[model samples]
Target: MTQLFSDMFGTIIDNTPYMKAIGAYYAGASEDGITMAMPWREDLVGDPETRVIASGVVTALLDNCCGMAVWDRINAFKAVATLDLRIDYMRPALPGHELKVTAKCYKLTRSIGFVRAFAYETSVDDPVAAAQGAFIVTALKSDATGVKS
Candidate 1:
């Protein structure tokens, strides 16, 4: 198994169909942060003219990256729900370019995890979007089987 899958929470995320379909992969984690990548897909493109990725997809990427950062720090297979996510889109991503997101969990309390993430196409210095969010972490329940859980 990949290092990402070796962790319980990441294993569950890897098996999720939607995440797989979007080509979101765990690049790795470090003391600095957790990184993930979403490979450009034709299906995810919103404007064929610009070949820019959809805003919704970008939001999802940010949300997942934040959640993963929290999970990596917590080192547990817990269910997390996004309390709020705010993204600032700086520019559009070019077609065929991969979107890389690096998320850092700067603060983690008993129930809430605070994260900040940036998405870039080719250069981290020139990010396409930046995000900050919070998530509510809870114990994984047997009844929660879907990816949303």
Candidate 2:
């Protein structure tokens, strides 16, 4: 990842309260997006009987991954917020399995970015959930180094 993005997006993620609470971590990067992982934890379970990871956790994971992809596509850090997010839950995430998520920023205009993402455990073909979202891109007053110029 570029230093600017690392500073802008990475730092924000690192410091964000909810993201930190979820224990998601940066996994890798691709040409169009980035990936992250969330390990299964008892505290993340929504149903005690089923021991299944909460859907809300998956939602946060997808949103964060998609947000990261937006920055990756921009190749820099700038202010952006989710404009819309729609998630389709295919199945419950298996307990004790770390969920992996990848999101792609497929399109970007001056003020918006379109993203798609999915969550999987054992295989990408068998996704636990999928999401499509839009984010509002803002003109940030920062230079290449992610510092005001």
Candidate 3:
């Protein structure tokens, strides 16, 4: 990975509280790729009857993975806002299975990044969900002021 992307990854892993709260750990990353792990907990499950994971949790995992892809390309601490995200749920995820999300940034420009991500239970060949999205990249700003310049 480039120095910029490496630096950005470090900044995120070290400073993002939400990422930490969700137990998002960096599995591995390269210049054009990233993998993140999120353990399934009962608290995050949505369907009690089916014992399946919630769609929101799946979305969050994809979002984080996609963001990491962008971060990996930029290689810097930047404020990112999801412009659009599309997720396709292919299969139900069991309660006890941990989800692994792998994302890649194939295209990045001055202010936008495009990424694709997949959530796999144990094998990449069998993905639970697939996602494609774009994110608006901006300079880092304090949370107190939601504005990004």
Highest lDDT scorer? 2
lDDT of 3 by residue, 37-68 (tens): 88888777799998787888888878888887
For candidate 2, lDDT tens digit of each residue in 28-132? 876536778888999999999999999999999998888788887787767778888999999999999899998999999997889999899966789999999
Considering summed lDDT, which 10 consecutive residues are worst modelled in model 3? 140-149
- Candidate 2 structure, TM-score to reference: 0.86
RMSD in Å for all candidates: 3.3, 4.7, 3.3
Worst 10 residues of 1 by lDDT: 140-149
Candidate 3, TM-score vs. the true structure? 0.82
lDDT digits (tens) for residues 1-149 of candidate 1: 43552255456558768778787877777665887788899999989888889988888878888888888777766777788889999989768899988889899999889999989986678999999998887767644322252
Quote model 1's TM-score: 0.85
Question: Which lDDT value does model 2 have at 107?
Answer: 93
Name the 10 consecutive residues with the lowest summed lDDT in model 2: 140-149
The total of clashing pairs for model 2 equals: 0
User: CA lDDT of 64 in candidate 2?
Assistant: 82
Candidate 1 segments whose C-alpha is farther than 4 A from its true place = 1-10, 141-149
